[model samples]
Target: MKILHASAEYFPYIKMGGLADMLASLTKEQSKTEEVYVALPLIGKLGKSPHWTGKEFPALLPQDDKIDSLVVSVLKASRFLEAEESGLKLYFFQSDLFQTLDSIYGHKEEHFRFAMFSYACYALSQILKVDVFHAHDWHTALSLALQKDSALPIPTVFTIHNLAYQGDHPFWMTGFLKEEPFRLITSPFDHDGKCNYMKAGILSANQITTVSPGYREETLSEPNGFGLSYCLRQRTLDYSGILNGIDTEEWNPKIDKRIFQTYSFLDWKEGKLKNKRELFQEMGRPSLPLDAPLVGLIGRLTYQKGFPTFLQTFTERRHLPHRYVVLGSGDPEMEDAFFQLSETLPEVFYFYKGYNESLAHKIEAASDFFLMPSLFEPCGLNQMYSHTYGSIPIVSRVGGLRDTVEESNLLKFKTGIVFEPNDTSSLGYALERAKDLFQSQEREIVVKNIMNLDWSWKKRKLEYDLVYTKAIELKI
Candidate 1:
């Protein structure tokens, strides 16, 4: 099948979150058997590469109440890093509007920017005769709506990474679609008389998907859906969930060169010890005891990640026996709070302001336990990464966290610790449990079991292939 995946962010070129990582891995997996292409907006300053090629086309766009157009260029390039090895073709929509943008998102005219990019992606899909149009999140949900507005019998699939971030704008912004034949389509949902990009995708697409089955169930119910439960309920038959996969080749412990030491499950214990000591030394700390639990946290320091609950746990339960290492940058107040806490509790706490790919690998390799106490997780990649790197995840029971990490029960094989979100006591208990597990023999078994489990795109991509075929069968 000729599949065209449309998303706002793609790894290597631009990445704001796991959406980029998942799309990159998914498309690469799909391209192994089928013809796969990716469409992404050329955001920020992208350097010209020797492997890249380009073509220009005029695209009509809605500017306010006026009919305006612009000439956009679609640059075709092989997947970055892999560079044609994966057989995935990436088409970057280049426009004057995107050229000056300093970042991939957070612009005042975000709706207008993505609308133009979406139309350009739709045009590219048509030119390439794509069999299916797959749009990711609200960033490119507009592409699915554009496909519907054209009445172009193209099968479309929309994947919701996070329902919380629907691109909603005032009804007046509908002026972008004011002209005849370009008017907005009526969605199954009405967002307070506003234009909601996510709702349009859910309404128009042939199939809709969330990152995990637990998350899909959450979306079809109240609160978790963030006001779109009714709309999702309307299309329950066509809605489904597929767990996102990690890049096994990039995240594997044995072959990874970024860490201080590398080992497979055979020598994971020794490898982890070496990595741990080196990591501590590098971070300006003495080597902690071998049995001491070194907990690692990586990602955006935001409320959604349960930073508030985590902060409360740290402040109230200072007697807990564990060392904490965090690496991320987000939400200024949370960052400041974490920094201050680390300063006050220097011996047991350490926080890094920004992300470093190599440091992330080292932390994962060295830490005895990885922490992700998320308020909600659509589909978390860190838990999977932690599993692969021999780090047991201590994640909350939400979304993909619950789906991916099985609780450590003595009767059955387990992967990691699971606790309730938003409860300081629950998190404190889970951390204590992790500390206990770290010193027990079961820790070895759990780490080995999780490491052996498959979270790669190899098997999961087949589920997507089924979804695409189903979409084509029920083509709208």
Candidate 2:
């Protein structure tokens, strides 16, 4: 089947969060079975790369008479040998819309920028004559809107990576939509008297999917749904969940050259120790006993990640004997708080101000446990990476964290631990248990169990292939 996947950003080109990782891995995996192509904005920051096949397609602009229409150039990129070997086509749209160094969202003309992208996606699909258009998040949500108005006979599948980030803007922002081409399209994009781009996609698409089974359930409720619960419930028959998978080849600690040491599931202890020592030296922590438990966290320093709960657990429950190394940047207040905690407890806590991909790998390999106490995680990739590196994950019991990390992985012979979301006391208790396990000889067994968990894309890819087949069958 010929599939066109559309997103705002993609890996090796641009990455903001797990969405990029998911798209890159899914495309590479699905390419083995079907013809997969991608459409993304050609942001100037990605600069120029050899992977893109620079070509242009037609785009219509209603207002400007002299240049009422222009050619939207595409930069086809597929750097991964596996994608090329499997015959996947990765296409990027090079337009002035993504040229600015400004943030992806919260721009003055974001409504028009994303709308243009969505319209361009529909145009590209028609030009390429694709069988199905698979779009991610609200950035490409308007593509379904374009398809609804057009006479195009293509089917669409929309994936909601995060329901919280619905593209809701004032309707008046889209002044150009008053023209002939956009007049026939119903304004279902307006939800609660506002332009809800995500709602429009969810309402219009033939199929809708989220990242994890737990998240699928959460999004159907009041708290986690972000006001789209009722809408999602109405489309229950059309919606489903598929857990996100990791690219084991890229994340495997055994072969990863980014970390200080390399080790597999069988011989993880030695490499883990090497990593821990390196982490201590790099973070400027004094040399401590190898038996000391090291808990690592890598994420945005935001309230959504349960940073406050983490701080409370670490500060109030001083009885627990453990060290924490945090790497992230967000919300200046939270960053400063973490920095202060590191200063107050120099021996037990370490903080890295910003994100560094290689350092993330090092932290995963070096730490005895990975902590992701998110209030609601759509589907965390770091926890999966932690399991692969033999670093047991201690996460809040919510969303994908609940689905991926099980009790067996957290028990005496288990790989990881889970606590109730936003419960500081529970988090502290879980940490104590993990620390106690480490002090005992049971830590090795736990690490071994975690290392044995399968996080490969092979199985998830099969599921995606099935989804693609079902999408095509429904289209037929």
Give me the candidate number with maximum TM-score: 1
Instruction: Determine which window of 10 residues in candidate 2 has minimal summed lDDT.
Output: 73-82
Backbone Cα, N, C clashes tallied per candidate: 0, 3
Q: What is the TM-score of each candidate against the true structure?
A: 0.92, 0.91
Tell me the tens digit of each residue's lDDT in model 1 across 315-425.
Answer: 787786788999998899999998997788778888899867789899999998999989999989999999999899999999999999987445378888899999999
Candidate 2 segments exceeding 4 Å error: 47-50, 59-87, 178-180, 184-186, 286-289, 408-413
Residue 75 error for model 1, in Å?
14
Error of 2 at 215 (Å): 0.4
- Backbone clash pairs for candidate 1 read none
Worst 10 residues of 1 by lDDT: 73-82
Report the C-alpha displacement of residue 35, candidate 1, in angstroms: 0.8
**In model 2, what lDDT does residue 288 have?**
57
lDDT measured at residue 392 in model 2 versus the true structure, 0 to 100: 85
The global C-alpha lDDT for each of the candidates, from Candidate 1 onward, is 0.81, 0.78
